[model samples]
Target: MTGERGSEQGSPVRNGAGPGQEGRQPPVIAIVGPTGSGKSDLAVRMALELDGEIINADSMQFYRGMDIGTAKITAEERKGVPHHLLDTLDVTDEASVSDFQRESRAAIADIHRRGRRAILAGGSGLYIRAALDVLEFPGTEPAIRQRLEHDLEVSGLAPLRTRLELVDPVSAARLGDARRVVRALEVHELTGRPFSSFMPVREYFQPAVQIGLEVDRELLRERLAARVHRMVSSGLLDEVRRLDSLGLRRGRTASRALGYAQFLRVLDGEADEEQAAEETIVATRQFARRQLTWFRADPRIHWLDWQDPDLVAKALTLCG
Candidate 1:
């Protein structure tokens, strides 16, 4: 498809076969990459140039008051571009992929209503995949959820993992970790079907284009280190302390976030500032590596080198 170059405020001009000939819908663009890879900045630029609104796909950025640690874009950074799904919930609230999918769909629909493109942007592969694929999980029974919570509190995750392995070995095999195992077992007990059975392989959206940012490993590592240091300098410890006061204790999902976890260790007197920052950097690097692994496995994404000066043009071409 080819189109006229339009201004940022106007709709993109289209010059190709219209939607529906091949069961395709209007194209939506997504910018995905490892954390600290400038995905948001690129998304903002694309939005300004392509008449798009950014829908955040990052999991952590959903929580309110998690700006510094999450590397959340500030108002000034957005440059008047409208962004959706960031800082929309309290840290105490549990936001899941289902919630993200629902909210993102609404945001995309709104963008389409405005005659603009929707730009999905973040490092969270699971959230992006959940939004793009028609993957649904079985409903959970309240009573079963309560029971599972009680069991988890009483016996911890090992028994839950064992139970899940017995009920749904496929899901259990895929979710052998303590956190995932508990969730899988909870879903199994709540709904009749295995968790794995709910995973749909069909496309959820139509005519979507995925663009991944690529950076040199050494440069990424250096940038991550600097980012962690900046977070430390920018009151990340204070932020963790506030969240801790909200009853988000250590080792829970919220507390285990990269910067927050390190600060929690420092709060427990387990580490010094230097040690905490170093450990946070290391953990973030490891997390980025995992993101790369996940993104690499997805064949649909087109990778663009972040170092390229004309990345926006390359991304726009890819979107076309």
Candidate 2:
């Protein structure tokens, strides 16, 4: 399912290595952490050292023109390593984890075909799992989905969340968005099964390694707060102004992105820029906490201190 390899440098993993190339090692690396934990930086370092490529698992990085807020690494930062799946979607379009699973698998396979290491990096938990694990997506009935959407629009998320709470408290508690709430209801209505039943067990679809960056909670909070300030100084407001012209508010997913959602208020004159920036920081810190909680539950992840000078070497050791 891998897409075309963007470079011709290294040998892919062993399974797909050609004749006389049985000795070549295929790398499947996942770098996961909180939002401001320097995951993209470490991923780039690993790619350069291992002759690998990066596949983005962060849902926000998928949107074009969302660079500054998502903290997307620049082209120069990639340092000639071929990065996959960034800036692939319109800001107005919603990204589906299942679609990401299909595309990222293809990209990783293609990276393997080229005999290069495949590094998956991002803070998005489910998207990362959907790509690297044996996750199955439930089928959606268009009519059922339409009805749910209708109900959400008419009655708001309360009724739908109540329904989901009755059928599946776990999913109801886990999900925060109206869209996802409606989806859980749809799944139950369609299959007579709780939405949680579709969740994949903790198992990889292929041989893989996960490197998690661990941060001190207070330090991470300060870092996240500082990062939000930098984004504002670096023109997050202007970026939102640009995307707003492209129907960002109408977008079901992109509209809800931490910084984007808050700044949209600024544009509408609902709040001042400083207020928007403060909200973004608060929201980002909460997001980072949730991210840490999610990754901590996975037993397979190898945790590394975020500030360790030899973090890359430590992560490499785990790959073997």
Candidate 3:
């Protein structure tokens, strides 16, 4: 599963204040919010205050050369604090939640080893949940995935959905969509277990704090629109063009990023700048809505109005 920490194979547990010492470890502070909600700013400030290092949880920000559209924090914006997992992968590479979890755990452990706090920040709820809850997924077979891919190409997702519904009704109910059903079925065919059954039970790092940023919907919409305009002005189209030249046009997960997908359409002559920007804003707004839904369902999050005067103080109190 993406973001779940498991026991290290062949590694011995240390006594007292050492690695894997959950009982004696310092808590990780996770700052999460929707895209365009200033989570990077908040995380940087929190890191400065708490002597923390940041581990990125956003899925899209990991790719190289995606700076403007993903709104990756500049080195100056990082304010001399160490940030991990940004711009670490090429666009041709595939990144997954499991990859994030493994890397993030190592980074967090290193931060703790250096006697600094670990700050997890970004807008990807799945990545954040994987880190916090330590959920794990079952392994899949390549042949099963290949067969499912063929089915998707020939009969579409209906056959896959029916197969998954028979094998993993709980996962089928939870997924409820064609693409997800196909994926679940692929995993079931590979592992012989319900996809959802592989999920780890909820777990938490004690003494940790979670801060969520919220804004008025209209305000967020305006911000998203303005951000899209700025990105276009900043050569986002050129960036997409370069990525497309690398044979990452569509269907790939990296190509599906809000700005990249819209601009790819522009390059295909299917849309103009204005249309691309409009579509990007609409997609981004929907993504933000989904993020809010995911975070709001978690009872542990300490909600903060984006304009709160004493937000940092409140977060520090929770961390203590």
Candidate 4:
């Protein structure tokens, strides 16, 4: 699924090409790839090499007590580079893409004002787009949203899903959860347009370069499995247990995280640790595949070998 890069080596990577961005700034560098593909490590290395700070694009890392399961970078790993938007939410708070876009743009502006380059890093594809792309979120109407949510509560997702399929089949095919389904219907009700019509075009809101780490599918599968096993070995259950006590199960988003969900079942006696580990490994691999599919569709990202010894240097060249 690999695609050709839009810019070549040493070519000036275009920034702020979207409409109304006349005073184009230096590109905000973003590192993107599937999970367990060493994105965090590479991001830190690039930040140090370029004298930049990091803005997290991973939604799962937003929760305060979700470190181990999300594989969040430690303080030492940051090596003094200020990372924004990590651990900014309680487990009970739902993550919002619109909120993330506002916060990330603010952070990017702050970093640039301080004369430091802004580096955005994470495997969350949509969050990455929200930060760097010229994307618009549909406004929500309180009455419409409340009504759809009430419908979802009373009749279940089937009715809402059917309504979405009739009004906005593209989103219906794409969105599977109750929350997103209700959101799609709400967007349609509010704007009288298909939810998919608002998908971001290939235009940057600011000067930006995306560097994607390419991995062999089989090798990535192995790495993800190994990583899940390591998380289990390194007190992931204890971390999940603690978060669960702090209202993890009450969280609409955090409770459904890949590793955390599987282990929460283990905590409830529905599964054992071994069963949870295997389930998490399988789910993580599937998630990686979905991430690859989303990223590969974008032709602007410069792809690099994850194992390349000079990965940072290559990425820097792309950033120019």
Regions of model 2 farther than 4 Å from truth: 1-27, 151-178
Off by over 4 Å in 3: 1-20, 205-207
Taken over the whole model, the C-alpha lDDT of each candidate is 0.77, 0.84, 0.78, 0.84
The candidates, ranked best first by TM-score, are 3, 4, 2, 1
Q: Write the per-residue lDDT of candidate 2 for residues 1-320, one digit (tens) a residue.
A: 12111111112122222454434545479999899899999999999988899999898898889999999999999999899999888866667776777788889878988888999999999988877777676667779888999989988989888889999999999999887788788778877988887786787777789999999889888988898899999999999999999989877678999899999999889999999999999999889889999999999999999999999899888876
Candidate 4 lDDT, 1-320, residue by residue in tens: 01111101011122344565436457899999999898888889888888899999998998888998999999999999889999988888778777777779889988887878899999988889878888777776668878988888889999888988899999999998787788778778877988788777888888888999999889999988888999999999999999988999988788999899999999999999999999999999999999999999999999999999888889888877
Error of 2 at 40 (Å): 0.6
Error of 1 at 18 (Å): 17
Global lDDT for candidate 1?
A: 0.77
Per-residue alpha-carbon lDDT of candidate 1 for residues 151-195, written as tens digits (9 for 90 to 100): 888998878877888899898778755655655766666666677
Clashing residue pair totals per candidate (backbone < 3 A): 0, 9, 3, 0
The most accurate candidate by TM-score is 3
Which tens-of-lDDT digit does each residue in 1-320 have in candidate 3? Answer: 12212111111111122454776678888998888988898898888999989999888888878788899999999999999999877676666766666677788888888999999999988778657664665554557667778888899777777777789988867776665676677666666777787654446633457899978889999999999999999999998998888765532567888889999989999999889999999999999999999889888888888877887787777788
Ranking by lDDT: 4, 2, 3, 1
TM-score against truth, every candidate: 0.86, 0.87, 0.90, 0.89
Better of 2 and 4 by lDDT: 4
Candidate whose lDDT is highest: 4
**Candidate 1 stretches greater than 4 Å from native:** 1-25, 149-162, 200-202, 250-252
Q: Candidate 4: give its CA RMSD in angstroms.
A: 7.3
